[model samples]
Target chain A: MTNPTAAMLVIGDEILSGRTRDANMHFLAGELVRHGIDLNEVRIVSDDRDAIVTAVRALSEAFDHVFTSGGIGPTHDDITADSIAAAFGAPIDVRDDARALLEAHYARTGMELNAARLRMARIPDGAALIDNPVSTAPGFTLGNVHVMAGVPAVFQAMLASVLPTLTGGSPLLSQSLRVFRAEGDMAAQLAALADRYADLSIGCYPFHKDGVFGANVVVRGADGGRIDAAMSDLARDLGL
Target chain B: MTNPTAAMLVIGDEILSGRTRDANMHFLAGELVRHGIDLNEVRIVSDDRDAIVTAVRALSEAFDHVFTSGGIGPTHDDITADSIAAAFGAPIDVRDDARALLEAHYARTGMELNAARLRMARIPDGAALIDNPVSTAPGFTLGNVHVMAGVPAVFQAMLASVLPTLTGGSPLLSQSLRVFRAEGDMAAQLAALADRYADLSIGCYPFHKDGVFGANVVVRGADGGRIDAAMSDLARDLGL
Candidate 1:
């Protein structure tokens, strides 16, 4: 069976402005691959409400699972949660369960649960909260969309909390062989090999470093035997 | 006048597989911002043909400019050029000018211009070549979309070659004020400040470092005076 497909939506102006390099997409991509899900697409959009709503809605409809990071904080620019709610046409308010969690955490810390802080408690109806062990403010899940924090630590924690609940297929296995020749020299052979092993996905990445031209051929597939045989054939063809 | 808007399409299986973190996006984002072009969206897709064609067509139609990185090499997996041509309904073939350049470079390097190496000479109809100073292979611009190499160095060179040809608006100016208080503590005042200067885009980024809670409020606009004034007002309101 084909693995469940997923998409990631990164919502932040910091990323678009080049103030921040997004780490969440890479993190999620690795984790989802490990969990046997095919991450088909990833989109990074700014903090604009319309962009967030449109991306979330489109990705949520196109993929089996949609993961989003950023803009769920207690600030004016933190419009991800609200935009997601609007995308689903769901009414959102400060839910008691979420508020109680925030309130109790703040009380324990001797901090006031003010209006801005309470904004984190706003959740759409029928949505479930994703736990944040790094911070008290929880991310939430509405339908297939998992809205998480922008902070790297909080986002990772939330992903760990949410990943166990989803279904997965066989983990994709990959093996790489480095050919110390120009990609042009090996293109024809590689193309023939790829045709022979149609089930396995072969990727050629060219690299030029220290006066050496080479390519790394990575083979990916669910069947380990097929991948192993393909690698062996490639090695033989390259005489390596 | 509003800044010209642009979108980026990153095409590669390595990025989606988490084997490589995309550095081109960060580099391009900074460069576009410097040139007064607002980077509105970035999409990363695997080396699948349909994925590349679909994203290129969508972004090229939606934005004033579309920049794509990766999959333009002499290998079976390098299908970006073909996909882009398909997206624009343009015929692609080995053009004499591109072939002559490749032949001359190969001759200088004492390398044979074989069929695979000659593959790089293929250009889409009506597209202008974006010079690759670092390498002999050339990138091209079809309609509003500029196709670029995936290698960081080559992509940077292609961007440098292509950027000066595009029209730009006033460069965006920005100023940041660091307030050593929780975003929750400053959200109301910050929201009011943002509303007061609606023309300037204000972004609040929360940080928890060294056991301290703080946020950096960034004010961005085309007018330097407006950005400075808004930043000063934010600093004063925060008692900084």
Candidate 2:
């Protein structure tokens, strides 16, 4: 069977506006790689409903799994769940399980479970709830889309709980060779190496230091031994 | 006049595979914002030719400007220029200007400008070259799309030169207030504040610490004086 593929939809206006740098995409990418699930694309959209709906539907159909982070909070702008549910043609309502979890959480802290706070209880029909360790507002999985909180801690916790349930491919393997040459100079040789090993992904990342140009060529594939072998061939071909 | 909007297309398989954490998107987003340009969307796609062609065509039509990073190297996988040219129905050939630049760079460094290196000189007809401070291989601009180096430093320098050539909208003004309260508890008040200032983008970013929930409320607008007024009213309403 082919490798299981995934996509991430980071929903936040703050991220798109340059107000907040996203840390979730990297975290989830690494986690998915470790589980042998390849994350092929990432789309970061504003908190607009149409944008959310369009992205969710498109990404859900394109990949084996889709994980969305953000816009699940109690605020009026937090519309991810509703949009996602609508995209799946699944009606949304306050589920009893989610409500009980929120009620118990607020009761323990002696806080008001007001209308705004209860907004977190909305979930798509026929979805399995993913528990948040840091907070009581539960994330849920509808079809292949796993919805999580925007806050990093809660999102991470929910993702950790959800990932174990999904089927993963062979974990990706990688090897790196740091070259003290400019990427442009080594581009052809590197390209040849990439072509030689069609299964491996060879990336030439350039870094500059005080007028000196350098690059790190990372060769990645599903097999650790094959990746290392390909890296050796690249180093010899590039004279690195 | 409407704000000059730009979107970034990051073309690379490495980024999608979780092999590399992207640094270019964040850099471009901040730089574009500082230059009074709005970055509407960013799409990270693999080295597939059709994907690049489709995205380039769509983004070039939608935004005032499109900045693409990665996939301009000498490798077989570096197909950005060819794909972009296909999108514009333009011929891709090795231009005299780009070849001369590469020759001069190789001459200065005492390196051979081999056939592989000469591949770097391929540019779409009618494209103007953008200077690369960190490397000799040049990036270029075709219409509204500015193809940039994937290397962060080189990309930043090329972008610097490009920004001075374009017209911008009114600079985006912003003010932030860090408050100690959960997002759910602060939702009603923040919503009212947002409703009062319809022109402003009021974002509430929540943070948790020591079993406490806190949020930073950022107010953004095109007008400096109006942003300040809105922020002041927000602080007064929140009593912070």
DockQ, cand. 2: 0.61
Q: Pick the candidate with the highest TM-score.
A: 1
A184 in model 1: Cα distance from truth in Å?
Answer: 0.9
What RMSD does each model have against the real structure? 1.2, 1.8
Q: Deviation in angstroms for B177 in model 1?
A: 3.0
| Tens digit per residue, CA lDDT, model 2, B133-226 | 7676899999999998787777888888788998988777788988888888889988998898888888888889778788888888788888
B64-107: candidate 1 lDDT, tens digit per residue: 99999998898888888899999989999998888988989899
Which 10 consecutive positions of candidate 2 chain B have the poorest summed lDDT?
B71-80
Model 2 reaches an interface RMSD of: 1.8
Stretches of model 2 off by over 4 angstroms after superposition: none
In candidate 2, the residue pairs with backbone N, CA or C atoms under 3 Å apart (3 or more residues apart, or in different chains) clash, namely none
lDDT string for model 2 (A83-133, tens) is: 999999998999899999999999999989998889899998999999898
After the best TM-score superposition of candidate 1, give how far the Cα of residue B32 lies from its true spot, in angstroms.
0.8
Model 2 C-alpha RMSD vs. true structure (Å) is 1.8
